[model samples]
Target: MVMRWWSDRWTQSAGAFFLEKDAIFFASARDFLAGVLAAVVITCWNLAAVERNAIVQASQKPYQTLSSRYLYKTHKAKSGRNIHDASFRVYRSSPAMAELLLFEDIFTITGIDTDGKKFDKVSRIEARSEQFDMQLVLDVNIDVYPIARTDKFTLALSSTLRLDGTPDDGVFDQSRKKSLADKYEYVMYGKLYKYDDDESGGAIKIGVYVSFGGLLMMLKGDKQHLGNLKLDQRLYLLMRKV
Candidate 1:
């Protein structure tokens, strides 16, 4: 019944949009839409903090470095491919240093017209900025199914921390930063989602496990993790923030 209703609705919408007198209008609208789509930019939001906004902040110490490790596993698959597998670690080094360690691993990718294949690579991502700069830098390669290839581009990933409105004042809130620093050792879990065409595309969800609450809350790395997320795969991330 749901399928039938969807089909009927699509048919009706298409018919109405393509009515005999609507051809010219449809063409113009399509061109306008294409242009708008080209101009629209893609930004990744922090799903963890957004979804768990009601969770009380637990950190009260000064902002410091945290670390952890986990087994990275993929529980979701698409087309003719299976999930990927890997090991992750975040070392405890310095208060100013934030590191995400991704060990060597194999990932599966299924193309639009071909069988799935496996690719393996190693990488490390770190944020050295004392304040949020919208861009997060990392030295790593990522693989998303159907379009399997390392991100050879030398560009730092971008992140949007505040969800309420533009923070015209400053990037980091001192009180909030202190809370994160205090609770730096807390355990946190989050889900990463991929929205391909902004509001047009459905979300592709990925699970993330963080050992350090500061990583997810303080450094705000969760906001930028979506840069390497894939729509065709469900990623189970076991990560630490050090």
Candidate 2:
């Protein structure tokens, strides 16, 4: 399965960890196995990088708290097409903030598909946090349709962030260049996959949808709301410094 995925153009481009084509073109079984092992190791390493230490461990201590939120939206016509958007939020916040903002914030959105079929869009996010610097990390799993496509894939995304300003520094100020209003930048990465029932017998064709890169804005905020948070195929979110 790994070998076949390696041969796919999408997987190669998404992961981009394969050896040179010539190195594997006519390789022996031993070489193929080596390539598979290399790919697995590289993939795991990359995932760990995106997951970040904030998610797995925080300095010498576990995170003091966890906070999470989820938002899901849908738009469908009487035709046969539909658009769904969702986001999962996990950040470092005080236990009080987590309970006040997310613990009971539950709602659902329902609509009719283009085929006149009824569908429901439900989402949720949960985590814990602290007040000092707002150090945070998140792991998001989404099963939805990507932008400009008619199919759905499960996207696993993760990142880390920490608030570095002070209350007097205008954490909620939008006019200043370095204010909390600035884009919250982080390295974002995820893998995309499709469920296929083919000659491989209902195998899942997985590919690296996105790899590690920073300068990509993950979160932003105004005095009242976070903006420009539509990451990886329309994962929109709103946030505020608590």
Candidate 3:
């Protein structure tokens, strides 16, 4: 009878121990599941917030889609090979240049053909920014769109002429619907080939180079002015004498 009594006590103790252990295990599992659920909720909320912000930005400026700024100073192009070949070769030394390639977009002509004519129809123009003090070396088709020294012009760079900021279709659009091009006098389409940063001057300087069917352009300035540009982007250069 004593042995049986002892057996009953031990069985009760073992049962209590196992019940307590099971309760602990279930409680931990429940806490882990709750943490995972909370994390998922937070992640979803963050993604929704980002989407809302993007929508707001897109709607804020529906008509003004191009990246633009004003430029006022100018300089002459250095005499050398064709502007296209010269700019390409300079950046081609970098592997990124081989892989790929605007404006608040205004500039004033400072110097024109300071060296000499590189091409009969194309004249290299040196220009400067009125606001940012950026420098530009551009080749214009003089026979088609004549630009002279001391000319004040607004230049805009855009991926698409559409005011709605759509991606370019890569086909020449004959549609006469008013576009960003309609507001400009001269326009050229090109692809950005290279982007580089130079720190030799103590301050960082950025260089952006593009080619419009061999008509070349180089823009150099601080990061604030060129930060929006991306490599290998197709761009439209729009200009109007302001």
Name the best candidate (by TM-score). 3
**Where's the lowest-lDDT run of ten residues in candidate 1?**
151-160
Flag the better candidate by TM-score, 1 or 3: 3
Per-residue alpha-carbon lDDT of model 1 for 21-45, expressed as tens digits? Answer: 5888888899999877766532123
Please give each candidate's TM-score.
0.16, 0.16, 0.57
Write the residue-wise lDDT of candidate 2 on 1-242 in tens digits. 87787679677675554565545665776788899999999999998887675433422231222323332333333353443344334535455323222111121112113233222331122222221111112222223321211222112122212233222321234445432212211123322121112233353221212212211212111212111122243221223211
* Tens-place lDDT digits, model 3, residues 76-175: 1234111111111111122221121135544778889899887899999999876677889999998887777856666667778775666768677897
lDDT per model vs. reference: 0.31, 0.29, 0.70
Error of 3 at 127 (Å): 0.7
Candidate with more favorable, higher TM-score: 2 or 3: 3
Using lDDT as the measure, name the better of candidate 2 and candidate 3. Answer: 3
RMSD score of candidate 3 (Å): 19.6
- C-alpha RMSD by candidate, in order: 25.4, 26.0, 19.6
Clashing pairs in 1: 59-179, 59-182, 59-183, 60-182, 61-182, 66-242
